[model samples]
Target chain A: MNAALPILALFTLLALALGLYARRGHDMGLEGWAVGGRGFGPILVFLLLAGEIYTTFTFLGASGFSYGSGAPAYYIIAYGALAYVLGYFLLPAVWRVGQANKLVSQPDFFVHQYDSPALGVLVAIVDILALIPYLVLQLTGLGIIVSLASYGAIDKAVAIWIGAVIVTLYIVASGVRGSAWTAVVKDIMILAIVVFLGLYLPYHLYGGIGAMFAKINTAKPGFLVFPASGQSIWWFATTVLLTSLGFFMWPHSLGACFTARSANVFRKNAIALPIYQLILLFVYFVGFAAVLSVPGLKGAATNLALFKIVIAQFPPWFVGLVGAVGILTALVPGSLIAMTAATLTARNLYGLARPDAKDDEIVNVAKAFVPVIMLIAVYFTLSGSSTIVSLLLVGYSFVTQLFPALVASFFPQIGVTKQGAFAGIAAGVLMSAWLTFTGQSVGKLMPFLPQAIKDFNVGIIALALNVIIMVAVSAVTARKALQPARS
Target chain B: MRPVYWIALIPFVGILAGPVLHNHVHPFILGMPFPLGWVSVWLVITAVLMAVLYALDPANAGE
Candidate 1:
């Protein structure tokens, strides 16, 4: 009976309506459904690409990170800026290849470039493994936002179930177009709300942004700067480097790149998107404010810092507005992730298994798999206790395994054979799983190493092993002509 | 690679310079901690450099 619950329900229904409406006038062929018919102009393409940035992860996870870990969260801002620099060059090349080959999914690019359905299947599996955790992060954020905004009237599990169903409904109906249409609304609402809270909170709590940071610095020394070890400078630098290399390696990001009208859209976006990414600084401001105000949000609960602070200060109607934007942030990315995962399953996994299946039939199979993927994500959301940022880093480690082979594909001189790409990805993914499961960092894995070297992001070690295996394997395997080595 | 593309590396180097050059809380830039401010400044520079690169590149010229 909370006013916020009614508002949340209303906006959720609006998201559903917008998503289904997006499917109108467009043929729901595999290409149209998955990549929006490859006709998105600059604005729509910008929303789609930028939409990937300001997700539930950025909405809650980032503020939560700043609240929990302090200065290490600034790596989020650094990695994204550097990633856009890489994307300026990387995405346009991806677009050219995608446009020329009519590639429908990220795995399709690998299949065409390597001429190996087997490698495509392998990539599909890796992408789905990585994507499920990301999807879980969105659902987890949705659950937290809804429950908090409703003043704990709604149960977390119930909120997540409702969110998953709503997302699956639109995604099954409209595919990427559902996400793109909702993204327009999500981006605007997030921008205004984040900036307002970011500026207002610090002033309201501690007079100003500088004053707020000054107070936190005095209270918790070294909280706003990197330490010499552990989550230290070396960790930040290496993490930023590794994640930038892996940024567009996300299947959904590559899928977004392919949705564009031309390669130039990426070139133009490379200019605009970095500026947009700085908005995370505002998000961080809100998080930093919460560290002192909403103290004791530890472990998995840190992701609630932003919303908790907002709920404490704002009335029910305003909290409802924030909750509505929170749901949009999740739904936009959640739908995109679900749609991409389902398409990958259909196009790369099942289609490879059944090579004679028609494109329309594969599209139907993808739609059917939306709910299946959502169910898997929901189960993980209910069970997992990791912080939202940690969940994403796990996904990043898995997908970044793809970065070496992907970059090598753009240049034939690198001569990464399909066999090499396959072996390297397998090795890297296995190493990531080992590291993640064992709860090991490079520091613990190799105790004798210097603090600087030891503190390197654990993913970089897997990447190094991947590159060595790739180069070693390619050295022996016969090189095939690299298709679309136009760059 | 075009020499113009080297402009892209400036942001990477600048932002990653956090641990080395700008990891401080004082002398705040635009009311942010030095590291955060440094990276925020580089974000805008990155956009400008990409804009410059976009203009210089002949690949985008015809379009």
Candidate 2:
């Protein structure tokens, strides 16, 4: 057996135990499985939403950004805090609409709110197209975590298979409640391990946190501060604004909002969630500590900066505990996306298929798709790799297009024409794709455009165009459509 | 549009002004770069503002 085998097995078993524990003595029905009976109060709702937000991206991506890209990493911190402010108003309305309409999944909201099954279908297609790749990304993160944590004792492919199997079974068995219960365990583990490493790694290596950052700032000059040159402040500000708008727009997040017993749960969570930002700061400390010591991490290799730092500084057993957190970060989100995707598949796509399905039938069909979604994600994890596929991980940009439609739903008087919303979404997706795949953000396309526009994230640029098209088209349509009907 | 709604803009503005205010490497505040320190301060402030908003909102008073 490998040196990591014992602790790895122990943590993995603990994960499975927690999954089963959440299901004990509860009657599992469609609503119970899908949104945890729409009865959860503040604490469970908070944990569920937190689990969904802090995925492999938070664990690996933030530290990677700090190590590789310099100061732009602060965007992660800025966006989440801003999002809570927005969600304070946005989610209560979303929850109110969801509760009134009896919406269980993402597409159900659009269908009931707009009274347009076609719009629901379009949103469903866009959402799932965006979501599958996100699921695949988390699976990939799990594979990397397992492979690296075991010191190459476990193969990446095998590790991903094990992760997929566990996540699939647990989600299928326990549903959103499983994900919530597991999150409670995952958050505790994450808090302990991160704070320990954050304080110890810096102080143990350097004299203290202050000394470490001071030395880096002195050596690299602008390294500790935001880049004053090519990575302009406009880029950072727009990126944060874009991410904040798109933050809770994800299908899983919207569905989770429906789980809250009252809008007060969301309101309370918005107040409390920012406290978790302090934990993210601890991870940032670890990332900043890695810079001078673990230098020369090129490209995707940068994601390993924090983990490699932990390995170099800590013992194997403690490293094993961190590895467990890595797997939890990946698996918790993987299970979430899988469950949400399955919810969409049964609730949305199954409607397109049968046209006459029953509620129980839809629920059963969704439960069945749990394994299929996991299989598809795992297949992409082990076998799929292409530029287009990787670009799909930029789901936030595309999904930000949904903001106009959603805001319209929250207030009926907003008056966005369905055709306009459709056109806007189509335009946003295409613009985002063209800008991203063409490397426009890197100064490859549209040379005549200003550097500032080019420097802004493609998502924000696409969102601007989406809003313009939506508003202009709606104004023209509403003037013509409203006059004849008002009489 | 209650006055409470404007409170949300405090964190939003503080972060958007990141490029303008405290855009420097020197003089770390609590062991962080000025921009980062600026962000960290506003993050906590955002929550406090949210708490105050919660208190002021007529919706919560009914409970």
TM for every model, in the order presented, reads 0.98, 0.95
True contacts preserved, each candidate?
0.80, 0.75
Model 1 lDDT tens row, A321-425: 999999999999999999999999999989977999999999999999999999999999999887899899989999999989988888877778888889999
lDDT at A22, model 1: 93
CAPRI grade, predicted model 1: medium
Residues A1-487, model 2: lDDT tens digits: 6567678878887887788678787767778888888889888889878875567877777787788777888888888888888999989888877787788887787776666667678888778877888888787777777888888888889988999888888888888888998888888888898888789878987888888888888778777766654566767888888888988988998889999998888888888887787678778888888998888887777778878898888777777788899899888878888888898888888867888987778878988999888888787767864322233337887678888877876554677766666777778878877876676663445567777665666567788888898778878776554221100
Error at A207, model 2, angstroms:
1.2
The per-model lDDT (C-alpha) reads 0.89, 0.79
| Candidate 1, position A154, lDDT | 92
The runs of at least 3 residues in candidate 2 whose Cα sits more than 4 Å from the true structure, single-residue gaps closed, are A384-393, A442-450, A479-487
